[model samples]
Target: MRITTKGQVTIPEEIREAAGFGPGTEVDFVIGDDGLVRVIPSDRLRGERAASLQGAISRLRGSADVALPTDEIMALTRE
Candidate 1:
């Protein structure tokens, strides 16, 4: 199938059905390490976002040196 000037290509009905891509389904395009592109549905997007957030939390887990309480932190921020 040809992509239009808008970079849009229609996926075949059979493939769409197999992939559970019904009308109005939210999708994301992912490029793999093997240089292959994949169409991922939104249901999987939540897991991906959670994993990314977990990674960030892990990286910042012990980076905070200050032990200020919530009110003190808020006061510092206001100053």
Candidate 2:
């Protein structure tokens, strides 16, 4: 696909879906030792960071491990 004057080329819908590139996904382009350019999704790293810090977050909530039903979890998020 052609890149616009803004240097933005549209990533295909299939590629986007496969890479989980939803709105506001941060990405980086890196050149590997093999001289191949790779696209890395930084947003996923953010998620990884959050997951790694889950224990700290839980601690803030008094380390409660109450298991809520899936529906209840969904309901709270929906609100």
Candidate 3:
């Protein structure tokens, strides 16, 4: 398994299947604290980020209790 001139190495079919990597799959390379590199699906990271964003949004929900309508807010801003 040699890296191409473009620094691209093909993952073996077995590894790809085991890792659930299909064609057009987006992957991320992570270096562990133990000095091991791993390839992970980008959606996995997105899922974590989505969860974090959901939590943040949930916390902020209802925090903005505005009584003004859109037009009124726009008018105030314009003024």
Candidate 4:
């Protein structure tokens, strides 16, 4: 396959389908010392679905008996 002047090449349809590449799917490019390039799916970085943190801190609400320093509490609140 040849890269056009725009630095783009049409990935063969068969290869794309077999690799499950699709619109909006993220991929990575790795270059070996031998000048070989490989395409890998980004999902490999995430082992599994992640849990939502929306309610993870719900338990901390109204649980503080002692007051913390304003600066320290503000730092934690930012996250």
Candidate 5:
């Protein structure tokens, strides 16, 4: 996939599913010694259990109080 005119690129669905990436998911890029960049789920990196991917997704659902509307969330992904 190509980056848009705004330098935005869509993550593949399978990668998103595998990485527990949903709207509002916080991610950081990890450049390894292998010269590959990995998109890491910030929650897991922050000491949240690696098996608790759903927990991160659920938090984005407003369980903790600050849920954004779908359009607003999608707009962020484009940026």
Candidate 6:
């Protein structure tokens, strides 16, 4: 498969299905000393398994909240 002018290449359907990759799924790339590239599920990239939203919220319960100005929040949202 060739990369388009935008430097985008379409992942083949068979590969995507086999890897369980779908819309919104994330992946990571690793380069070995031997110059081999490996594609890994994003969850394994940071040595973290995906957690539910509830778990994430629970983990943040004790974190201090920093209030941001409305304009800053809006700018961040746009990004």
Residue pairs clashing, model 1: none
* lDDT (Cα, tens digit) per residue for candidate 6, span 1-64: 8979997777899999998989888888789899997777888765554456567989989785
Give per-model TM-scores: 0.69, 0.49, 0.62, 0.49, 0.50, 0.51
Q: What is the C-alpha RMSD of each candidate to the true structure, in Å?
A: 2.5, 11.6, 3.2, 7.6, 16.2, 9.7
lDDT (Cα) of model 1: 0.95
* After superposition, candidate 5 runs with Cα above 4 Å error: 48-79
| Model 1 alpha-carbon drift over 4 Å, by segment | 58-66
Residue by residue across 14-78, what tens digits does model 1's lDDT show? 99999999999999999999999999997798898999999999999999898999999999999
> Residue 42 lDDT in model 2?
81
Instruction: Output the number of the TM-score-best candidate.
Output: 1
For 1-79, candidate 3 gives per-residue lDDT tens digits of: 9989999999999999999999999999889999999999999989988999999999999886779889998999998
Total backbone collisions, model 2: 0
The candidates, ranked best first by TM-score, are: 1, 3, 6, 5, 2, 4
Candidate 5 backbone collisions, by pair = none
User: Of 2 and 3, which scores higher on lDDT?
Assistant: 3
Weakest lDDT window of 10 consecutive positions for candidate 5: 43-52
Q: Rate the local accuracy (lDDT) of all candidates.
A: 0.95, 0.84, 0.94, 0.77, 0.81, 0.82
> What TM-score would candidate 5 get against the native?
0.50
Clashes of each: 0, 0, 0, 0, 0, 0
Error of 3 at 64 (Å): 12
Error of 6 at 18 (Å): 0.8
Better of 2 and 5 by lDDT: 2
